[model samples]
Target: MVGRLDGKVAMITGAASGIGLGTVELFVAEGAKVVAADIQDEKGAMLEKRFPGKVVYAHCDVTKEADIEAAVKKAKTEFGGLDILFNNAGISDRMSTITEITAEGWSWIFDILVRGPALGMKHTAPLML
Candidate 1:
């Protein structure tokens, strides 16, 4: 059967676990190639082994531009091009009060939730079009 995402290529951040990992599995099942990006080295490698030609693992920290850049490049190189950039990596401050939110904490959240997605777009947009 032809899958919904047949021939599409996706790069998924935070992909070693949680929703990101779920997306990676679904995308592959749907016939999309995926780059699983995360700091979890073992999980990432395992996914690559499990999915074989359908998935490649790229070590990525959303807070780091170099890592994000590397992921984009990996998608392009390994799969021929990028069709999706799934910006799913994020952080939160569940226990911190507003006053307890230090500048570093704020930056960490913003870097992962906002700037990382933006960076993903910035780096991948050109190739996507």
Candidate 2:
């Protein structure tokens, strides 16, 4: 049977665990090659082994623009081009309330939740087009 994503290539952030891990599995099962981007080296390495040629692991800290750029490049170099960008990396402040959160905590969350995806989209748009 022809999978819906046959011949497609995807880059998924936070891919070492949780939703991103699930997505990597789904995309691969549907015949899409994947670039699994995350900070968890061991888990990310496991993904490469689990999927072999269908998945490439890229060490991506979403807060860093260079990391995002590198992951996008990996998708292009490894899979030829990107058909999808799953900007799924995220985190939460450990503080109990917003008032308890420090400026650094806010910046960190903003970097991951907002700046990260924005950078992902910015870098990935050219390949998708």
Candidate 3:
């Protein structure tokens, strides 16, 4: 039987490790062409090596629009067209309360967790649609 994602192209951010990495692995197993974007160059390289042609890596910081754009572009250029985008890049602040958080701390967490995903969707939704 053919794989469910045969001929589909997928882009996954934060894919160097953890959930992103797991997603990439599963996508590839299902025969989707995958672009794995992350800020961790070394780990990204390792993933590329492990998956060979099925997985490509882009060094991306999801907080930056340019990086997100480039990653999406790379997926299209490499795999023809984007069919799925997994905007899973994020960071968490383990701090206790809002009052305990400094202004800069709030900004940093929000930039990574909220703004980054928002920007990824803003850029990627059009492509997917």
What are the per-residue Cα lDDT tens digits for candidate 3 across 49-70?
A: 9999999999999878899889
Error of 1 at 48 (Å): 0.3
Best by lDDT: 2
lDDT of each: 0.91, 0.94, 0.87
Provide the lDDT at 52 for model 3: 96
Model 2 segments beyond 4 Å from truth? 93-96
Model 2 pairs in collision: none
What TM-score should be assigned to candidate 2?
A: 0.96
Report the C-alpha lDDT of model 2 over 10-114, residue by residue, as the tens digit. 999999999999999999999999999999999999999999999999999999999999999999999899999999998743544767878888888888899
lDDT at position 103, candidate 3: 90
lDDT of 1 by residue, 6-90 (tens): 9999999999999999999899999999999999999999999999999999999988899989998998889999998899986
TM-score of 1: 0.94
Ranking of all candidate structures by their TM-score, best first = 2, 1, 3
The top-ranked prediction according to TM-score is 2
Poorest 10 consecutive residues by lDDT, candidate 2: 91-100
What TM-score does each of the candidates earn?
A: 0.94, 0.96, 0.90
